[model samples]
Target: MDLTPESNQDDEAVGDLSFDPKGALDAGDGAVLTRLARAVEAVDPVPDDLVERSLFAITLAGLEADLMEAVYLDTPLAGVRGAAAAARADDTAPAEAKTITFTHDSLTVMISLSPAAGGRVRIDGWAAPAAGLDVELHRPGVDVVTVASDEDGRFAFDSVERGRASLVVRRTDGGGGAVSTPVIEL
Candidate 1:
């Protein structure tokens, strides 16, 4: 027996076999969901700026960007050799400098933060397995400052402000993609 519907009578009879389109849609409370979504949107629509920012973030995430996570290691202050003397010098003096280390599969970066003249911070960095590379320093509210590593894989950025900052290291020839460290407080 061919069960396939061929005539109008067969099609109309098929409709009696437990086929309820509205009930199917309501089985999972889908109608309630649709109503809730519409009500919420009418009550408070999403902000345009937030939508723009979300789109921008999604676009950036879609880019082929490799991000390296820099781990913070506990180390002594970079420029403070005489911790006791420096502590005794002035009670109102600025905080001691910091040393940060970032390790990746290909390279390891170590940097020392010290106070420079004119109330600015100086960054001294070294790359291990030593090859000259490009180093970038990013500070909040300031243009990104960049420097090139010497033959010894050493780089420095002087007169940088004291605040949140981060670093990126890349090949001098721009061959490999850049790697970035986590943001740190200066």
Candidate 2:
């Protein structure tokens, strides 16, 4: 068979069609773009909390706090927050409470999450080497809440809405720098 455009019935060359990159798109062009967008969405949809997650990451990146590593988990999940976060999505699973422990240098922080009064979470936390400290609760789309730890290095948040959250701890006496736990799904 002849490879030339003339060999075909239509005889339309590949270069026959033209598109102006800077020019305004016509109705047909708009329809084509719209179809492309819909196809992309159908193939790979975006997460509902993508923007929140992105903002959370950006905020954490600029905080300059020491990132504490997850040391212990009381849930069935074996790994860190990532695994725990994944495990909590199954509603059919048992309503077992979760405890996560994170540490940085000499400071050890532990938090236990349980059901609260209004379908929220109650965060009871304790820090070792008990000193005056400030713990801030951070969620993707909510305002940060701060509470001071008592003399016993214990603190509690009465209620918090469930979602991706983290805790940032700082010394109240202006001693050690700040430290933050990994983002976990609550």
Candidate 3:
């Protein structure tokens, strides 16, 4: 029971000789890990498409609850053939209708935006694999307008103010997750 430094020394000498488990990474260990990461990155760099998809997925994760994931497929404006000058001229011309598509696991939503009277845009939308769902149009600082899809899975929002907007499709029965499209400019 006489606890002395010499006794403690003797106990430790005969006790487990294993070294203390490493806790935090030391500078050299961290350097080695950094080198390893660099080597891996060099050997197989991340794909550009994969990174884009990952960011898209992250955005979907932050979306409203009960909303299904939808990926932006394409916009007609993206395919317009013109240089900067031509594009500027085109912008000055009468605004023509443009189509955009968003895809979900179960359905595809397509919408055409056309300029209407009173400086508003008309949104006509269709959903493939048709279902009687309600489509809601969302715009910042504006009241949400909702319309039920016809038997043909077609819906329309008239007199939508020009600006950024998005869409959400939900089953009338509220049985499944709602589908949301990315915000787009009209």
**The best candidate in terms of TM-score:** 2
Best model number under lDDT: 2
Candidate 2 ranges beyond 4 A from true positions? 1-55, 73-94
Candidate 1, poorest ten consecutive residues by summed lDDT? 79-88
Tell me the tens digit of each residue's lDDT in model 3 across 25-124: 6677778899999999999987433454345434544546344444434433454112222333455557667676777777788887776777677889
Give candidate 1's whole-model lDDT. 0.66
- Candidate 1 regions exceeding 4 Å error are 1-65, 75-91
State the displacement of the C-alpha of residue 126, model 3, in Å, after optimal TM-score superposition. 0.4
Instruction: Report the C-alpha displacement of residue 149, candidate 3, in angstroms.
Output: 0.9
Over 23-108, each residue of candidate 1 has an lDDT whose tens digit, in order, gives: 55543477679889999999998743345434433433433435555554364453222332353345358746667678878888
Of candidates 3 and 1, the better by TM-score = 3
The per-model lDDT (C-alpha) reads 0.66, 0.79, 0.67
Q: Give the clashing residue pairs of candidate 1, or none.
A: none
Residue ranges of candidate 3 with Cα displaced over 4 Å: 1-92
